[model samples]
Target chain A: MADIVTTANLQEPDAFYADLVAAHDGLSKDESDAYNARLILLMANQIGDHVILKKLLQEAQRTSRKA
Target chain B: MTKLFEAPLYPYKRCADQGAGKPVRHPVIVIGAGPVGLAMAIDLAQADIPVVVLDDNEKVSTGSRAICFSKRTLEILDRLGCGDEMVRKGVVWNAGRVFFGDRQVYDFNLLPEEGHKRPAFINLQQYYCELYLVERIRALQVAGKPVELRGGNKVVGLERRDDHTALTVRTMEGDYDLEADWLIACDGAGSPARRMLGLEFQGRVFEDNFLIADVIMKADFPTERWFWFDPPFNRDQSALLHKQPDGVWRIDLQLGWHIDKEEEKKPENVIPRLKQMLGEGVDFDLEWVSVYSFQCCRMEKFRHGRVIFAGDSAHQVSPFGARGANSGFQDVDNLGWKLKLILSGKAPETLIESYDFERERAADENILQSTRSTDFITPKSEISRIFRDAVLDLSEHHAFARPMVNSGRLSVPATYDGSPLNGPDASGLPARTRPGSPPVDAPINGTWLLDAMGHDFMLLGLGIEVPPLTELLGLPVKGITLSGEEIGPDLRTRYLGEAGEAVYLIRPDQHVAARWRKLDWTEITGALSVALGREGEI
Candidate 1:
């Protein structure tokens, strides 16, 4: 029997990242940045934690500005 | 004296026949306890309107018929205080896959737009959704804001009197007469209420038949929907495989054009077909198998006198795009607020006519789109087959194949253009920033209109000045004032990109009813009166 996985099982950051990469057929450098941005948003939506989502968005903006 | 009628499933214990006892009256009486009817009751009750829901069925149906809820539906449910619970139980599907024969033709992801609170789609059984809603209704009933549910109490006859509708309901134990200000029919396709009204249900009915088999499988299938054209097992037939919650899977197989309905029900012939499509080694037991004929039809009119139709009672669409239930929910969403407005005496009687016009148009559009999708998915004639094959063949080599292969338009939101309630488009706004496009959140110069609020008439203006617009019109308005410093880069970009103005008025159903860079009382009041169906407005 195939393993029965729930959303809870897929909630881990590592697992979520792995699934994202797999879904898009691996991540290039440019794709990785976009993927990270999308990942933060998806996590924020699922978690319903707007504070974390806002903080992550701010951090990404800061990093982009610095670069 | 003996009771006139009685039934075990009747939620109420009263046993009295029509003309045998005193009459009972309610503000609104709804038929069917399905998702649509329940949604209507919830909306009306929340607005402090008294309602009574009647269903022939004794209990909630066990199986999941429609499992997909769009983001708009979620917003409506959210207003009823059950959106979070639904989101928690349901699986969010952001991606979909299409298959041409055995080869994967196209795959697309539904990227969640910024500022939208809900995802593109959520998958949960309709039965569970109904159960959750019923529980909420029960709790409200316990708290004194009651919505009476009469299960197994079927409406035997309906009479629309001058001021009210008289319903003759029959339970196992007895019969009773009930009167209500308005009647809404949410019964299934074979709606007795709709039939009583003698409304014409006209549309195309496909000759092809399909067998739906629900199975408990242990195979490793992707969570995305899979459609196979001319699958390996049956070259002439098409098959669809979709994932459900738990270990369940739904498989739809075309049973060919010349299938004998009676013979197809036999398990002997059915098991072999199932095994052939699933392959030899797959171990899965079928829980249920049923055959269904596809039909695309809609009522000529959604409303007649005090009687209104919703859900399957209003229209029926092929299952190819899952448009039936989704469109039904949209109907309730459109009708709910209108009913609330009319019942509250905030709008004129003509406002109710808009509900009929808008929902009939919506149902027709849904049936048309669903028919087009079914034609694309399952081509009937030889010419259609050749065209379908050619399209798939072209998809393999062409760069534009992605859009051709993708069924994204199936899930697209219904656009409200040519609607009587709509206002003239302002010229200065960017072409893409028109109504029905994505909404942007900007600083509240007075009140802010957010797209996250789902379908509703929203007036956003500069603070106290906007109060006159609502006070005079008796309409709800939100005020927002934006300071230069408060606007962030991303927010500013979206606002400028989408709205192209500082202030705008949105419709109840989220189409831009009217918009202005600044509030003009003359234009605003005129638009309000037109939307409310008052004379000499615009």
Candidate 2:
């Protein structure tokens, strides 16, 4: 399963986000935030197991708060 | 009050008028006149609910974007009365071959499963599918259950109200506001409806582009799919060829990372590449060629307020496994029955949310699998490319290599284990016959028992009986008894094996919604309420 994820995983989220911002210029900050939120949600859902997802979400939230 | 068609393109024009002035609205509004949207509309309309379908294009697009229809989709279309037409026009393909540089590496035969009414896949253009649907809709309209098709009209803006949705549409001559109880966007990948709703489409965009040429050919390429890793003519480039009806062949040419897109547009530049691949004295004419880029993306949310998204609007996968359109049709199938129940007031509004939950998961799985396939076929990085080549090299001598080369992941039906609607399968059974899996035939009444015909829910029970399942919920249910001698080994192993003795309710989309060995009306009803969204007295 990890092999599947590692083999086909998209480029780094930050890099993809940067490309998205560049291609779709004139997007508002709110739109960008919404887009980021959706990306996170989709990734979490694909991870499937709720326990691991909850931990990941908590870690993300903590890191964001620290930043 | 004027009837539909009394005005030009009746429903759309009338909807535009009603939008301008207050008028009675329907519970759901579906955008796009394509087969997927029309299938949803047909299901809802048959259940005695009014639905408005809007399309910007005046006429159905010609030729086939999706030429292959799976058996599951055919069953859904059959319920809508257009199934026979699809079967009639489509060329049934039972066998497929995969070639490795002119050598047939592997082949697959999709024979009809026992008791299944149709073949595995049918080849029919998307246009014909839409045409059949349009014919059905028109017939329904004449029968006084009208499905509004607003052609030559565009949805300009979308606004959600507290209990409904307000849509601003632009027609040829004017603009008007339309209100609906709910909205569904079946719009294509570049969905303006999704954009207007401000949802984000997230995924990766491949830098590699392929030239898709639809041409008339006389070459003796067998009725099989051919993929060359590195053809002699275009070294280090990939080429794909597939047979279509009427001597038409669809070819895809990988133009490396650095070729000029403009130079490739000339017929002169493309002819040499075709001749080289086909060999000397090959007779064929180039009809059309265009460059296409693939992206693997899906909308963040499949629903917002009273509006929902389906098909390409929800996710976009590569064309490798033909997952893009097939999965979209599956979305239509999944959402159709749930929406019907909700609109009829038999189910709660929350049941509609589960449509998003289930279909989005299916879409994500599809995109993930397809992206993996693209990587395997055309690896990007050096290490990945080396691994791919190594696999291809081993494929010649190893038997296990054949399955890996076949890309079985693309053909598997998506399982919905994590859906909110799925219940616990407590039966400690083998993996094959687990609950939440496909249905199996069992023995009953001196004969083998099979699933009920038509596209509706089925509840299979053994010994234990619960309160009339569908009657309690005010939804249609077909109850079948699975008892004694007739249960086949495969069937017993597939479904009944899970809960030694239990009741299994199958959703219209052929997914297991809830299952239990003992009759616990409270838990059964609770799962039903969650799956259907409302409670009704039996």
Question: What 10-residue stretch in candidate 1 chain A is worst by lDDT?
Answer: A1-10
Model 2's DockQ score: 0.02
Screening candidate 2 with a backbone cut-off below 3 angstroms (N, C-alpha, C), the clashing residue pairs are: B19-B177, B348-B533, B348-B534, B433-B494, B443-B487
Off by over 4 Å in 2: A1-67, B1-24, B94-115, B205-208, B219-221, B233-237, B255-265, B285-288, B406-411, B428-456, B462-470, B482-490, B498-502, B518-523, B534-538
Model 2: docking quality category: incorrect
lDDT of 1 by residue, B1-538 (tens): 2211122333644433345567787778999988889888887787778888888776665556677787767766776768777888887766665667767666667577644566667777666687778877886787787577778788988888887889888887777889888899999777898778666777555546878777778677567776677776556667877777666677887776687887886789777877876678888878667787755677777888778888888888777667767777777777777787788898776778877777777777776676676676667676566556656655555544345442324544465566667664565655444554424433332333343344445665422134422454766654444435544444455444444345556666555666666667777777767777774743
Over the stretch B1-538, how does candidate 2's per-residue lDDT look in tens digits?
4321133332344444544456446677898877778887887787677888888876664444666677667766766888788888777655665555556555666566664465566766666688788889888988888577778778898877899888887887777677788898988877888888778887555546677776777767567656677667666667877676667777878775577888887899888888877668878987667776656788777888688888887888776677766787778877888877766666677778777777788887887787787777777776565555555555565544555563324334566666777765655544543444544334445444432534666666764553343554665676665555544565566665644566766677666777777767677666666556553433
What number of clashing residue pairs does each candidate have, in the order they appear? 24, 5
Q: Candidate 2 chain A: minimum summed lDDT over ten consecutive residues — where?
A: A1-10
lDDT for position B273 in model 1: 74
RMSD for all candidates, in order, please. Answer: 15.0, 12.2
Q: Best candidate per DockQ, number? A: 2
